[model samples]
Target: MSELEEAPPESGSLAELARKYGLRPAIARPRPGVYLRQLWERRHFILTYATSRNVSRYSGSALGQLWQVVTPLLNAAIYYVMFGLILGGSRHIDNYPAFLLTGMFVFTYTQRVVTSGAKSISGNLSLIRALHFPRASLPLAYTLQELQQLGVSMAVLVLIVMLTGELPTWSWLMVPVVLLLQTSFNVGAGLVMARLGASVRDLNQLLPFIMRTWLYASGVFFAIHDKVVVSAGLPEWVATVMYLNPGAAFIEWMRDLLIGSHDLPRTVWVACVFWAVFALIFGFWYFWRAEDRYGRG
Candidate 1:
């Protein structure tokens, strides 16, 4: 007989019985090689599954993908009224609507990743428990769905710009590069949230409010540069903290490309790229550390 079969029953627990002899727990050691290979072998399965989910989820509605455009337009209108008309802000920034919309678009991508990743494992608990594939794939597939949607949103923005007389410039070509960095940042944050929020459900609820604060502090709806540089009483540490925000780096880099006669320091672009890479590495490690636990309830 095998060592496990020959083991003596000890105490009341199966774990104790197994441990009393020489048997190890079944779930304790998953086949990492098989797990990774399963992910690669089922790439097509993942792609098709993710695509169908995106389509059915959005297309089931009456208006269909029209909500994509409607959602942002409504957001822009609200911000215009609150920050532009009532408070009479954005006077310091040129093409306020365009500026606000660009930042919102970028921020929305990250927000989607964070919120969705946070709920991915919990929402698909059955799949996680039953399936033997990499848990990382769950968060990754969710991020991919958002990326597809973001592409549609970007196309809408391009059309809006054309109608509003914002012609594409040579600098517009740099958009894809900036977008790549933004996506990297999202993937990183998404992966981290998947594990963190799975361990603690509270992270999911707290993320949105944190993101809203991040949005305002990012200088999307207003210019904080002059406030940072010229205000004599402002502490240097405060300005440094503002500069460290990844959203702020992304917004400033985007404005340099989108707005004419405006340019950001090279360091800003470097900062965005740096943080994007940083987030990706940190998030991947954080998520992977709990790989085995993810399948547990």
Candidate 2:
């Protein structure tokens, strides 16, 4: 009978016993702290990926890197014509160009990060399957790519602000702080979207519509505070909620810094900090929970 039951029990080594029972080392989920440490260890890879993406994004195009600046400028021009000129969105607003550009630039950063993050997982399935690195690196890399693009775009925005007669001032120093808060929010958003998109591939198709709606709601084309709150006589709580919107808060903060608009309300600052922290903590935990399932069918 098959070499007398395959051998003596004493000769069964641990590996043989494991194979006989179809048992192997348990693939326990990593502890959160360990996962984070692993992610930190891969920070250089993340940065390199981000830098590579930023540099190569327009490599095939005739203008190459100029498209980054041109894309947003084109959008700004279209919005200026449609909303500013045709719809009178800029009515009663001084320095409308700077106002619109600041909002567009700030909000675009979040939009790009989210859209790119959504694609990060689904688009890199092959790499995920082949590599043993942390999956969070994908979304983080995309966020950093968008952040690099934002840095370039901000230079163009600053020039636009100056040309529109809004000189740089001490308030301009606050721009980096606002950008940092928004970057944190974008990272969290990217993580959440990466997980969601992997599970529901249709999310990529729907993100553009969602982001478009968000853009309008974010006061990118008009002054929500002046046009809606002051003119519509909306209740105070509603205004508070609108101002607290992370997108609107960021856009308004940039406007204040770039155009000498009214100081951002204390509540807006609180809201920015709150959203940044909340999104990051929740997003990371949510994403980490699904780590083992990332590449599975």
Best by lDDT: 2
Q: Please give the RMSD of candidate 1 to the true structure.
A: 4.3
TM per candidate: 0.85, 0.90
Clashes of each: 0, 0
TM-score of 1: 0.85
RMSD of each: 4.3, 3.9
Instruction: Find the candidate with the highest TM-score and give its number.
Output: 2
What is the C-alpha local distance difference test score of each model?
0.77, 0.88
Instruction: Put down candidate 1 lDDT per residue, 1-297, tens digits, no spaces.
Output: 776586665557777767789897544534556656766887777677678778887677898867766787788889889987787677766777777787777777777788888988878889878866678788888888888888988887777655655778998999889889988888888888888878886886788798889888887676666556554467766666776688888878777787674558556788888988998888877777777787575
Native-to-model Cα distance after best TM-score fit, residue 224 in candidate 2, in Å: 1.1
Error of 1 at 23 (Å): 9.1
Model 1, residue 103: distance off in Å is 0.9
